[model samples]
Target: MTTLASVVSCLSDYDPNALPVAQAQAIMRDFVQPVSGVARVPVRSALDRVLAEDVLSSIDVPSHDNSAMDGFAFASAELASAAGEVSLRVIGTAYAGVAFDGAPTAGEAVRVMTGAVMPAGCDTVIPQEFTQGDANTVRFARDAVRAGDNRRLRGEDLARGSAALSAGRTLRPADIGLLASLGIAEVSVRRKLRVAFFSTGDELRSIGEPLDAGCVYDSNRYTLHAMLSRLGVELLDMGVVRDDPAALETAFRTAAENADAIITSGGVSVGEADFTKQMMAKLGDVTFWKIAMRPGRPMAFGRITSDGPNSQGAFLFGLPGNPVAVMVTFYHFVRGALLRMMGATDAGAPLVPAVSATPIRKRPGRTEYQRAIAALNDRGQLEVRLTGQQGSGVLRSMSEANCFVVLAHEQGHVNAGDTVQVLLFDGLV
Candidate 1:
């Protein structure tokens, strides 16, 4: 129910003319709320889904103290009095699913396979490679292993009754395996968020349509579809709405009716032909901001009310039109907000520090996200170099770069070898 007026009234020094990047982010954080819908899904099907509740371990992870390696297990006391080497008689062999029932005397050892429960009274394991002889008897160097080594203690990975995963966590492959280890066949997770998006431009045409002299194919919709698909949201692509007030209004209303959030590329900037701005004002209390950021300075954000039978309202994000600007704005702004809507509790993507290979011209008032290639230098340290083209319209720049070199709002010019923050495009997904 938060309107632009209410958000602005709360700020002491609010400036609609040129808002800071942090201020815009703060507005979004204060306005958006996570969805409350929940569902029970199989653990394997919960990958990338936000956990609805904390997962507690029903039993110990290993369920018993086991050998961490294929080795001979014996009491640590047996090696205490050893001078040059420790020798012990092998009592019996224990496989992964089996255990040695008989207790081992001080001079006796038990052959234990990896994941096999430790033999009774055994507290250490010497890998077969470190010991000489067969299951009958084994001898190892006195300093081969420390006392109480190579034995995985029961409940060490996850103790029974302890929280295995916290609420709001996005389940990954490792998390799924951990849940399986704890005998969790199903988990409660938040439902996937539905996002409706479209492009606003009269000169844009779909791929199958014939290209006019002044019109180009609408690449923004395809890119948006790809990007949004990667985020695991249910996407409702409303296609390209021509630059007409009536058409734009219909598209906006339809998006608001069907989606939790709506994204549109183009028509937010100061342009004579931009009917999107006028129509957006009539439909909702959205605010158009010229943010202190490079490439994507103009953006529109707010909630739009829908009057359809099943419709209530939806969050709106009007991004810039340039091919690269759409992606830059999405990653920097829309991505985090969408994640919040999906009920994910991740703070944000981590910034990596790297040495700049070339000097960068920058001002102190605007944040810049320059596409760059980050790689290891001769010293095996991460170093970044700018992509060939820095133009916002050059979609190739995004394709050529592995990361975005982020220059903060207050940052000045950067010299070569200067350390800078880089947000990687790959990994950590």
Candidate 2:
């Protein structure tokens, strides 16, 4: 097992205070281990699940040479010497699900539909639209097609006995379709990861509770539930834990025993009432970092263990209490970590580039994720503009934006027409 001490000792430039974003990410990558259990599930139930083994194709994709269009199939020798127009006698008709049994002579053509198996001795197909033909014969221009045109050869898409999909791949919709084409009915995939999360603070209240002078309804848990659901993880919500050491420790132990990972929002800052940091230090090997980033600077990461013989530990992440900070932290850090725990080997989210529609104020030492709207400009080029407010506590900024303009740590102020990097919230549908 990889411990926090081993990971920290390997870092030559490790600094808990003012750590860079890349450094923190490296630490996280070094500390995580993928889960090993696998379950056999139907292809439909394996959506978004990571593959446990390679899936090889049992047969060729097309299984035979097929016609790619609704046209007449004939030997290319008949049209080789024709100057203006070529004509051939129609011998038989071949539909998509049926094959032509008879081989066509040199001057004979077989009427073929799309996906029909290519008739014997036929190497080319002339689309129906390009030809003017009758029931007995078909005529087309000499240059309409070349030899071997519009013919889908066997195993063009996927060859038999080849790997159709590899292990550690997170299955998407297109992957499911590919599996169906390969006649794969069931797949061995990693089991869904279980994550236990909670909110900590005396000032936080549930939905039905009355709003006293200093208490506000908790929104972090609701957002966490939705985000975790999108990531396809089973959730164990522990509700709000008061700002007491005993209650906090109880929540931690319970979460450690039941979940593969524990997520807590609040009580990790440098405030005097924050007992979470102390309890976390006592319970396990945890590290508090002040990252060089915006909206999410303070975070705690480590693993925690419970007492007794039957105890099993869980990975821990302490997020900030602010509404937007919680989401930003989750997306940038916890999301990838959870995917790794689920045994997925997909690369991190890709960042797209677009022109900045307006100027942006930035510094050189800290990375920032500014909420922005990415849309096409008058020239049909992608451009991005910041939302109304960018305060860490304002959740509306995140809602109003479709993408986050990622300003790098070494980047300075951006001009109006400068290109900026962005991570989209929605991909192509």
Candidate 3:
């Protein structure tokens, strides 16, 4: 049986660039791939795209100091020594988008509406609701207003030349609103990564096709396509390729010429009919071909370099044929690599802590990633229970599970109530 130690040694000694998970991640981290340069897109179409450059404010957000309420703008000294009743002459009126023609003098005030620019020499504002008004004058009930009350200062939201959006920030709805507030009509963002995906095997068929006696409808392609769509990736569906080497090679050549990355589910294991490994050896250098985790032990990573005029290169990930294994390995490895290629500096799987609800027995060698349903207990702590079976082919078990209860490489049988690390599929998928 392949053990975790054997797997680690094989991967570490395979090549200078191929190593254990940590080492591979470190190498990927150090090799910085340039983000595809920005494209000018309408603000409406820029949602979720990473900002290619910092956005500096071209003008103050509000543009001018304005009134925050429908009130009166007046000199503070006019009401400084007033009794319970204070009166002032109405000099002018101001509304949103219309500034007062002149400044208010010592004993006068201007009727200002919300968002109206404050008149010069006006230092205070009293809400109209709190004042007694007539044709030409208004009276305050008391000295309840303070200097600079009910005013939106110029540059309060954002100042000219201030950084409004930093580089590498993924735009969201609020970011769009902020940009709209600043009158920005367009933005520069990174283009989406184009990924080519397919499934291979003679035993697989499309969902609508008549199923042969032993063949099953392919599900991994749909699942992977959905996940990649949610990540904003442009997808090239290569469809299903049969187990013949010529067909597989044609698919690989097309993907290598067109896509940034090629992902295939199935045909990377130790079986004699596993033609993916054979083709990989002939077409590119297999960086690594096995992992130390269960359900996804037969994972392959390699690069296909072009040998023709107008040549280009691409990365390939060959996943095990089992439906559950395909999902597991994609989350653990392929997703991170894709995120890096998209210029995300801190992309990786998230590990969460959960307590076991039952005992789990396993050999003390290979790491176990058991399908589990995780829920919050009465005490609001995370508790996980294993799915029905642990077979790699148990796709239903994984579909019903919300998390993976992880057992370390050296861990043996775990007792009930033992604390373990659980990776939730919610965020990752």
Better structure of 1 and 3 per lDDT: 1
Each prediction's Cα lDDT score? Answer: 0.90, 0.91, 0.79
Q: List the residue pairs that clash in candidate 1.
A: none
lDDT, candidate 2, 68-166, per-residue tens: 999999988988767799999999999998999999997899999999999999989999999997899999999999999999999999999999999
User: Evaluated with lDDT, which candidate comes out highest?
Assistant: 2
Task: For candidate 1, write residues 334-373 as lDDT tens digits.
Answer: 9889989988888877899999999999999989999999
- For 1-429, candidate 3 gives per-residue lDDT tens digits of 222234346443544322344444444333325346568999999887878788999999789889999989987787666777779899889999999999977678999999999999887789999998795898886667876788888899899999998877778799999999888999988878878989988888998899999989999999889878867878999999988889988888788777778899888777647677777767775544556568777766666655655436567788888888888777767777777777654444578888899999987656778999999999999999999898888889988998898887768998889999998887676
Error of 3 at 186 (Å): 2.7
Show where candidate 3 strays beyond 4 Å: 1-20, 27-38, 65-153, 308-310, 345-390, 401-427
Measured with C-alpha atoms, the lDDT of residue 249 in candidate 3 is 84
RMSD of each: 1.3, 1.5, 6.0
